[model samples]
Target: MPKFSRRRFRQAKTAPHRGFPPAAARSAAAFAALTLSACAVGPDFVPPPAPASAGYGKIGASTESAAAAGGASQRFAHGRDVPGEWWKLFHSKQISSLVAEAVANHPDIGAAEAALRQARETIEANSATFLPQATLGDSYTRQQVTTAQFGSLASSSSSSSSSTSSSSSSASTFVYGLHNANVSVSFSPDVFGKSWRTLESDTAAAEQKRFQLEATYLALTANVVTAAITDASYASQIKVTRDLIAAYRTQLDLLEKRFELGAVSQADVLSERAQLAQAQATLPPLEKARAQNRNLLMAYLGRFPNADKGEAVDLSGLRLPGELPVSLPSTLVRQRPDILASENQLHQASAEIGVATANMLPQFTLSATGGAQATNFTSLFSPQTMVYTLAAEASAKAFDAGSLFHTREAKVAAFEQAEAQYRSTVISAFQNVADSLQAVKHDAGTLRAQVAAEKAAAESLEIARAQYRAGSTTYSIVLNAEQTLLNARLARVRAQAARFADTAALLQSLGGGWWNRIDETPASQAKPTDIIATSPIAAAIRAQAEDARDGR
Candidate 1:
């Protein structure tokens, strides 16, 4: 309980001028005393406990590299804290720079930052309610008054001219200016801590927005890094296609010369030419994919496709991060932005229950006005014309078909809903981490298989070419071998790229290390590229709460 008593309402005799009976006055005073002597009404929020589960449960809490996935091994360091700059672990300056550029320029980040700023400002505005509100006002008026109503019945019979003069003298109209000025102050005494609860709710709402901003940053930075990886993959695949095309052309040239020497049939030469054309055909689509991927990259950088500066990366440039972090399940619920945001919502809803309960309780207001009134502006503050008023009001509503009670019940339901949602968010976050972990483990297997197949196909292609050159096999066999190598080569590039993508996804699922960011309030300001400030730990729990009625 906190008290700042200006005065207490005293019960007195119900005189003719008294507004309420003595008994009612006493009841109000007692209510005020009891409420003022206690803390806020309704239950305070307690953060939900983290789950007791020790591991990511059958989802490969820890993993060792498969023997077949050799060279593609990623060591998952369980219970390790993810670094704030996780992308830097890839050791790609290209990726790091691109992420920085996108963060600085993205309109979505600016919008999210603005939302967070607005929420903070709202809390600032609500803080004004904690103190007395004072207003100063002045006004003037001009009007006319006459004394005709106070005149006696006229003496009619003796002299007409003298009677008319007497009447005119008794009733005269006068015009005058009127002026008034006053300063009035009013304050609500939060006997039940309605003010405190309201502030608590608002603060929670602000926190929710901050978390939303963090989520935005997490999504943005992760997507940028992933897109860059994909772009590199596309470029790598394109180069592989061109190399395959070149190989086919060389084989086709060899077959055409053999046909000219009558060492091979014309049909064999035609088959080799067809294979070369088919390999060439694969080039256009790969080029298209790479071009489109570059366009997507341009968009992420907040630029038009035509504005691209040919900022492209090579697959060889990105070093696969050797060490990867895997947070404990308990830590993830707190670190994940969505979960934290949901928790804030629960906090806000808990506060709302207090607000609603307070609304149904007695409310008290104190006000005072003191100033002066005169016939002119210069005389408005004169002592002789001074006047003042002091007032204390107490009110409580009763039995309006139970609207306030039902409203309070609604807030209870909302709190329950928020609690459930918080749990749901936690489940989804863990699922994400599990899914990424699986990708990290299995993508390697796919890559290893593709790499092996590509090697085998290349060997067979060489053997077929040698056999044809030695007149040991048909030219058609060489064409078939070339086709197999092309497919295997493309598959290997894809599988290799999948490894990078999976690593990025896993890092993202672990919450992108936003809690370790350098800037706590960077979203509102345009910081430098290297500031690492666009993200913060989700400190907000957004409340889509229904507004509770406050008894004023």
Candidate 2:
């Protein structure tokens, strides 16, 4: 062995025992840790109590129950409100079509749907905490280096000369390449229930979004129905105004004859003309309002506001069912989508308090990883080249100067704020139902009075025509009777429209006709509510709706 220099020499380190921690062993450790914290460090979640029955005002008995009592069970009974297809109660095909379009295409509704999708994706991402995360990777690298030492070694002479040559020799070049490929798996066991808490919070937030979607739908339908009713009313008023203009024109013609006969002053003719002008002016605003309402309906259908393609729905043609299909003391507040959404918000706030509280205690996580590495590509798959790591970490905010405490306190305040907001929403719903009920009743009475006045005016106009024909009354009396009849007819139209408007408002205040169904739709038959309630958290709230209906 005369000090021979080998062409190549390599050293490799292998961890033959390297692999993921034993599943049973790691599982046992995690179970032991979590079992010790059976009562999580944070405040355990407690759902907000259901809205109390007290303080709700009297708003007439529900007519929906009367309809149900008639042995109609195919549809929702008195307390059988469901979520999807709630608008079907209106029994208007146009309404159904418009709602379908809105759900599919309305920008706001589309945004809400996108938000729901993102929430589902977020749920999937968060689920990684409970499952292992895996990664597969490959790397390649090349590099060049200058080596003056190699150049000097080739020119070796005397030892001293060789040493000097090593210092002064031109640089030499070296090149090499490396490739590495590996697949790794990692996990951090949820020993402290932090992941569970996060899941709970996210679940609540997703539910809040769902209920918000429902609220938006409810509001949109309300706007559409109300606008349609208002438009019909204006159409009726326009007709009345046009008829009044005709009556005024006839009166003015007669008044001009009276002036030529020296029976009435020219002032009387001018007065008649002015009355005709007033009637003409009244028609414009009513026509404008009617057109505006049509535009609104188009907009609700997700079309251009001034779209001229569709036939305007006549309010008179729409017969609101004689009875409503809702309950008394109006669960409207409890069932309203906005209110339900707010309740979900309160829950999220409650869960957040738990999260912030958990931060006060030490958090423990059991982590594990497994992979393989080797300089030789062929050895990469060998057990000798495999690598594994198992670790347990304990962390805490050691010195945050009471930041955790303050955060927890802030979450507590937020929960209280949400609670107050929920209560306020309930109160507002009650007011709406009460006001709408009163409106319905008063509008009904007013319509009756208007009909009576119309009859009286018609009779008076007939008497005036007879008296003028007999030359016993001045033309002015005929003109006055015509004006009176015109006012009464327009008043009747206004009253009728008012009745429908109030009825629609009542329906809106009572959370429409769909809040009474108890059964949740399955995935196959799943509608909007089903899709929204897909999450366990949203399902829980929907279940609450059924429970409350059952007086639970």
Candidate 3:
């Protein structure tokens, strides 16, 4: 309910000293009266309240995730603010470097930055509407006019006088050079807040763009982290598969010797050979996936598919964060960029309603022009040649086939639509956070079970090999044990990778610490390492980026 100042019209110094006519003076007084009485008309915008739910999960439920290898139990620290560089929590050098590279060189980030700049400029342009406009002009023309065109009486009198004087007279054209100069001033006061509403709409639009830029930053960093984790996961899987193939080939060798010695049937060797081929088949797909993941990482770094990336990563090097930050439901609405952007759109829609309503009322415009005119350029500014005029206009549409009324109705509908969209965005944001929280929790339990299964399979495989060597167990038993062990190992690797990826997802869902950033310009210009060097949380990773650059 803030009151805005009215834009007052003032006469320019170049205006003629004679001032305005009586009618113009009366109109000016009326305009001033309207300006003082007018107010911005429409429903003022108010932000939607946060959802009534207190917790992301069932009431009184624990927010801690189960413990597993490569990560400890992760607890959601409610009301804790996220760090500016949330990726540093992983403590991985390769991930930090990749994210920094993407932020600096990605085309999408640049485009978003440019869009924000454009929106800011538009707001600035719209602000100028509150100022009066003045223009100065000068012109010279040479023209001729016939005496008869002035009046029939003047023509007839001149002709009669010529006849009486015994001289013939003709309607002659008079030609002269006329010069004129003038300065004009005009202003349309926002008596009903129409111009102010327009400015408000533009300002809100700029705010929306600013939030979108932050969203872009958050998305880009999260994607880079996810891609790096994928690259590491695929590499680990491929290596484990190749090792399994080697074990199978060795087992086949022993089976073949036993068959030659008449201790085993030929069928056993054939069966072992088939298993070895199957295990070998698994390698090609893993290799293909690993290659594809590498290319994707390069793309995320804004490089070509075959570009030289100096270092590689696997699950072995990346550490899962033990602590996670979670904002309160009320804070989530403020922290999330998409939600904030939606709220700004709602604000703009509310302002539009005011603009539409103002259009249906009377509009006031005041203008003045003063200048000099003379037949000779030297006499243009003389007192006798001076001329001036002033005017004011008030206009209101008497009838327009209900167009203005319908337009206001449309604006009201748009405001309602924006409000609905804002609510939807808030609901979706909360859903994202809830989903990530559950994934992190279950991923840990899966990893713990997979680890135990892998250990038991290894023990079983060792016993089966010993029993077969002593001629106490069939080759089929050893084959089954070997296959189980291989499956367990692959599952363990995938589980470890999942833990890392889900941790990153949790950070993204919580808005990626955009609030910690002071301004948008820094992310676009400064390197991630440089920006986070002063933070204790990022000190270790900052060293890693520096070391990588130094070929350490």
Leading candidate by TM-score: 3
Pairs in steric clash, model 2: 64-324, 64-325, 80-516, 80-517, 81-515, 81-516, 81-517, 82-517
Global lDDT scores for all candidate models: 0.71, 0.60, 0.72
Two-way TM-score contest, 2 vs 3, winner: 3
Two-way TM-score contest, 1 vs 2, winner:
1
Q: Which ranges in model 2 have alpha carbons more than 4 Å from their true place?
A: 1-105, 140-181, 330-334, 382-384, 464-481, 515-552
RMSD of each: 10.0, 13.5, 11.5
Which residue pairs clash in candidate 1?
207-540, 208-540, 208-541, 208-542, 344-541
In candidate 3, how many clashes are counted?
A: 0
Show how many residue pairs clash in every candidate, following the order shown. 5, 8, 0
* All candidates: TM-score: 0.82, 0.76, 0.83
Question: Residue 139 lDDT in model 1?
Answer: 83
Local accuracy of candidate 3 as per-residue lDDT tens digits, 308-387 = 56557767777766567877887887678888789779878877887888888899998999999998988986899999
Give Cα distance to truth, residue 198, candidate 3, Å: 0.9
Q: Which regions of candidate 1 are displaced past 4 Å?
A: 1-38, 58-72, 149-170, 524-552
Candidate 3 all-Cα RMSD: 11.5
Q: In model 2, how large is the Cα lDDT of residue 429?
A: 76
Q: Name the better of 1 and 2 by lDDT.
A: 1
What is candidate 2's lDDT per residue for 1-552, written digit by digit as tens? 011111111111111111212342244332332333234333333344445564335444432211211111111124434334554554667666665665555676667666766766675566456555677777767768777656556556545776675657667688866556666665555544555456557766876776666566667767776776677678778877887787678778887887899977786688678778877887888888778778877787778865557555565555555554444454555566777678778767766766666667677666565666665677778888777777778887879988988887787778778877877877787777667766765566677678778889999999997887677977678778878888898888877767666766766776654344332211112233343333332333344334434555
Kindly give the stretch of ten consecutive residues in candidate 2 with the minimal lDDT sum: 8-17
For model 1, residues 391-438, the per-residue Cα lDDT tens digits are 999999967799988888788788877877887888888888888888
